[model samples]
Target: MAYSTTIRRRRRTRRIDRAGNPAAIGRWLLFVAGLVALMVVVGGITRLTESGLSIAYWKPVSGILPPLDAEAWQRTFAAYQATPEYRLVNRGMTLDEFKSIFWWEYVHRLLGRLIGLAYGFPLLVLWMRRRIPSGLKPRLLLIFLLGGAQGLLGWFMVKSGLVHEPQVSHYRLAAHLLLAILIFSLLLWTALDLLEPRHGSRQRRWRAMAMVLLLLVVVQIGLGALVAGLKAGYAFNTWPKMGEHWLPPELFALKPFWRNFFDNAIMVQFLHRLNAMLVAGWCLLIAVSTWRFEAPPRTIAAALALLLLIVGQIWLGIVTLVEGVPVAIAAAHQAGAVLVLALTLYFLHMNRRTAHHL
Candidate 1:
């Protein structure tokens, strides 16, 4: 009788360890992930529109309220005039034109603030009620810290343009974008970990492939950011070949040779194209391996879905480039990248969980 009682206690403990109020926590996480997606899309628009440097200040608290009166608007415009972008690029921009860019940056910053509040308040409530699983506390706290760092990193990127150049550094833009994607992926992975079932046999090879695919997707995103930063898409404006050549001649013409990878528009766009090919090839490998090994049904389905999304993403990217990276299509492509990353994380988390069960 005592042995049976101990067995029951252990089962109960395992159940508790799996999750504490998972339904509530998972829902919150999904909501935050959706918001992050919106932020990323809007951020892309802000960059494409060249509105990222309009505000000229990072007022985390007071900047919430946009210029209300005409006098206030003039003051805002005057501040922008002091920056190099105004003198070098937008010298003739009027107040109305200034507002057009101002709102995009404003919305981007507002969304960032909202995400912070949405995440923090609910987290506090859940923690007070003892609804968050103890094992998850540290992970959630780390995500919050990363979120804060992302905000500062964004300002750092903006500060670069404000000082001497009309454009932010491609490196800083890549860092900011990469960090945001990382936070979004982490939230998605944690939420799926909490909500999904934990019973299945693991495939070690498949697990390794999924992780590799995830890392490649992240690197591709960073490359895409660099392409956008350098406005590289507008230069080539062709697919399968960059302006009638398989490899553009001016790719490495920049001084110091290595500067071409980040600063040279031709080289940046070429690298992005090469990286996309690598990512697509990796996805194909994962799909074939999963099917050959006869992995779990969930794993197979995820692998197939990932393959489909990546194919579509590749198509979208080509179209976006062929058409000169139009705002609408480019934003959709950016959002698609996030979705691919989220799905990849889901696959990796599920694979690891299955291994743990085994």
Candidate 2:
């Protein structure tokens, strides 16, 4: 009983103030969220450049430094040459070309390592110092585990391409991308919860609306990932319609009907297009609702930000597809999805009531 009372007193002593953040933990999480967003952008670059399979190996520790010498470069290139991607897709590619792709994938992996360090190092220090809030301890641990799992899943996705297929499985690709988004969302949400313990409006209706919009955005993001995995954007380059018709003649050309949704490039692109419309419509509805009800200033600001993001994301997607998925536009389009998701998360947290305030 005495020990319990002492623990309660300790918790009470570490109170939060509106002007300040929670012992740098919330800020640290925000910084980690930024790194995850960068990782997503770099992942897009790695895929677009056909560089994902260039590395051909996953050395969690030793791969930190790139090939340092001529002999090292040659050995690394030789290992890549043994892969199915090199043999089937990039056959006869020169050493200089191999180096170009190798660097993108290397940087991608390096960012992952850096993110892990960025999150883990601070968490360890804070934990040892007993600065972390008791309510957030288990949540942080879970986030760390998810980060480790994401690394393993990334390698699993890469392994698929190192075999017979020159490209990774679209299913694995979508799963990998969604998992990254999940981690990012979790980080962002936790940070918000810590930073604003007394935040959020009392409007439960707006909370539901925000949640629905967030789900729509997440689903649309998954569809975009599927489109990328299937290389669907390169085909459907028309705006307002799909190449002279609202529906293509071969929309469902695959034998099994469901396979068309996953394996058929045309169908995948169509789904992505349709989902984007749904997401945009939902965002508009929520933005207008926030104005109609005269929500708090911060709430309206978050909604307005989300509204603008959806519009910009729609334009980016169209330009990317119409321009035949140019590397720069395509990378921006992928990055834009993360930005939209981040803003949506902010909007959701504005109205969400959680039990984990410190």
Candidate 3:
């Protein structure tokens, strides 16, 4: 017992001795993860307000500044006036009205630009200082590249709405959202790996359950993107019953049937609802198993967080649906998904190691 206690003390001492650069980098990644979440919230607002296509053009550099004077404002408005959205829907929108929508998209894009700089500049300094873990260097580079691809994807999604139709493609919207979530997940997982990293593998309990939950959450979130893209929430205002019955009658409305899952508005909303039930059930099972088994401190905390957040998310989704998808409520619903995913990632990371010691 005396020798074992001394070894534990030495291990703690060594841990303290090893905490400088990687720790700072971990904290930095957390900060970046936060910015990503904020951007998701703002993106929700932008979509809810229909401000995504306000700028009418993607200017990587010169577009940073909004219109400064009446002439510039008119020119910008003229540009928007050329789009299908202006001609078909917002024909008589004034300059001040234009500015209101413009700011949301502007801030959204501006935030994206700022995030790029925030990540890239600090990363360069870290590389120069040799602060990054050797194994993590490639992962960080891939994340940066993915970030760039995300920017391109955002514009691509926006461009679809600029063409003949006044609405963006639901498929493209789902892709964009999924990619953003992916980036956020990677940023978070990487940060956790650095901050409270495990030294070696242990017997992970309920590992399969956690993986399934994570996958279900991702699919459910994507289904949500479909709901938002198709504006399906507006189609059905009653829940626990999607209009009149527990099952939507139009689940296979499209000819191919599979297309109904993606393109049909009513069908999309139904699948999203169905998927939510699976996610909730699976989460409850995980929570129970964690309570019944011997789980680590962090894992237990993560499970509780998931339970609370998942319950809140279900309630929020119902409220959002019944309230006719109001901007504030709908945006909160989207943010709720992010929170649930964050906890799920923590749970998965925690389950990978068998130690209950920490």
- Give the top-scoring candidate (TM-score): 2
Off by over 4 Å in 2: 1-23, 354-356
RMSD for each of the candidates: 3.0, 3.1, 5.0
**Candidate 1 stretches greater than 4 Å from native:** 1-20, 197-201, 353-358
Worst 10 residues of 2 by lDDT: 14-23
Give lDDT tens digits, candidate 1, residues 1-358: 9999999999988767654667568778989999998999999999988899999999999998999999999999999999999999989989989999999999999999999999989888877766677778888999999999999999999999988778898899999999999899888877776666464345778778888888888889988998888888898888798888999899889999888877898988898899888988998898888899887777789999999999999999999988888889999999999999988887788777352210
Instruction: Quickly count the clashes in candidate 2.
Output: 0
lDDT of 3: 0.87
In every candidate, how many clashes are there? 0, 0, 0
All models: lDDT?
0.87, 0.88, 0.87
Give TM-scores for every candidate, taking all chains together and pairing residue i with residue i: 0.92, 0.94, 0.91
In candidate 3, where is summed lDDT lowest over 10 consecutive residues? 349-358
Point to the candidate with the largest lDDT: 2
Q: Candidate 2, residue 272: CA error in Å?
A: 0.8
lDDT of 1 at 330: 95
Error of 2 at 217 (Å): 0.5
